[model samples]
Target: MITHRLVRTWEVLPSGGYSTAWAELTGRRLAARGRAVGLLPEPHWVTYTLDTGDDYVTSRLRVSVDTAGGTRTVDLRNDAGRWTVDGAYRPDLDGALDCDLGLCPLTNTMPVLRHDLHRGTGGGGSGPHDFLMAWVSVPDLAVSANRQTYTPLAPDGQGVGGPRASRVRYSSGEFQSDIEFDERGLVLDYPELATALTR
Candidate 1:
């Protein structure tokens, strides 16, 4: 069976070109164990949530970094199980995942999910950096409230863990330390460490 979702996503790229993704993923009952598609692909955990009646999945992603000293990667997955993290909005962000912002579907997009985020990373000029994100099942994107320049407005959706996350722009001069996380305040992807590898 397939489950539907009103997931929330946040993608960020540092001034140095390192990308970070923060996605508040939520949906109906999902598979207990599956692969969460991301910058480097990682293992996922599926569980149930009392508030949204959805699966509160938490994934531990694998991140490899090449620093000037050497290369290292930390196994950042705690216990793979269900957790309870539902409320208004997690200011601390239950968990966060770091990845290559360029790898996010919002930048190029693929069959993983069909979307209409033509905003293109926002770098148009005199504006903020644009954000285009959509899950595979939800075609009607949650825009308007965020004033996104896209199609198929879906204003009646929640951001899974809490209130929907706002779409950020690079031009805004705002930079976040991490991206891509679960409601449990976990970090899914780590790009800062990865950038050190490329350099």
Candidate 2:
């Protein structure tokens, strides 16, 4: 039962957004708890807990948010390849492979680093890997595993493995960013968002 801990500060980049999180990893399973306050353009307090296994191919996510509208809690999960939200199976999410909790990019580390992701290798971003993710939106408390894409980037000097460190761009709708991970597949930094490491 090997356990690892990590902490990261979340920001909105060049503005006044602040939050922090603590995460624990045991073997291939991960459990994380986090809180955010004063996230730019919106004033609210948000808290979340996320758990995953099999290299993040499956997950159970919970989140609560307090804002001018009110407070609400959301719970979601993906077992094997099946997805559920607030204890109900979602037929719309059939055949999804991952969960994107809209809260943090760290969750992206699980599949990008652990899966045998040769989807976009040497293709100049041609064959982008599409992850059918159980997506979550905190403030709205909406949950679904729509469609998201992860595209591998060229290698760079950083950690271990054949390419040392790796990069991947996560895209959904109009959202996208290049995320870097260490050799162990943990996120080193998420552009304009957060940086993380084992403690």
Candidate 3:
């Protein structure tokens, strides 16, 4: 299979930190590695690797964190909707299709690609679909189930000569933001969270 490489960098708006990622795509399956450093709830750095099936659902995730206190790591795997965290079965994460790494924009690409949202269209029909995510808290690696929604939005008529971009309204509880994505389903802007840094 021919492999395609993608590289992206994001600036953490709130923490003045940054994240960079390198991904390889092979026949719809994706494998990625990323690093993040931030000063939010505390000073910390993180490194992660993610693997997903052809359907764009997360299959394996490994995250490592370094803090002033110490270093810790977590490994999560999803096998046909069943999940295991750190080699232990996590019933609470059952049925989750994706993992949301805190402060990482790269994680959002899966769902957007799955739903064809990057093309400014719903997965199949018009919808604000709900998704179950294994939310990983940074600096702690605590895993939990999070219910999030993704709503496809019409383009704002801004991309005339640049790369094709799409918009989506991402909502979790009361927090909501209109995120912009590139043609490849990678995040371009994530409102108050992060923004892609062009090279």
User: Which numbered prediction scores highest in lDDT against the true structure?
Assistant: 3
Model 1 regions more than 4 Å off: 2-15, 18-54, 80-199
For residues 23-135, what per-residue lDDT tens digits would candidate 2 score against the true structure? 77788777778777665456778788888776655577788988887898988877776778888889899887666655565567666755534223543343577767777
TM-score of candidate 1 against the unseen true structure: 0.24
Could you give candidate 1's per-residue lDDT for residues 23-71 as a string of tens digits? 3324432212111222322221111111112222223323343334354
Candidate 3 local lDDT, 1-199, one digit each (tens): 8987999999987767999999987877789999989987789899999999978889999999999999999999998888999889999988788999988999998888887887786453457979999999887999999999999887678752255777889999999999998888888889999988853
Residue 25's C-alpha lDDT in candidate 2? 72
How much lDDT does candidate 2 score? 0.67
Where model 2 places Cα greater than 4 Å from the true spot, the runs are 13-16, 116-127, 156-165, 192-199
Worst 10 residues of 3 by lDDT: 154-163
Candidate 2, poorest ten consecutive residues by summed lDDT: 116-125
- Evaluated against the true structure, the overall lDDT of model 3 is 0.87
Alpha-carbon RMSD, candidate 2 = 4.3
TM-score of each: 0.24, 0.77, 0.94
Candidate number with the higher lDDT (2 or 3) = 3
Q: Report residue 150 deviation for candidate 1 (angstroms).
A: 24
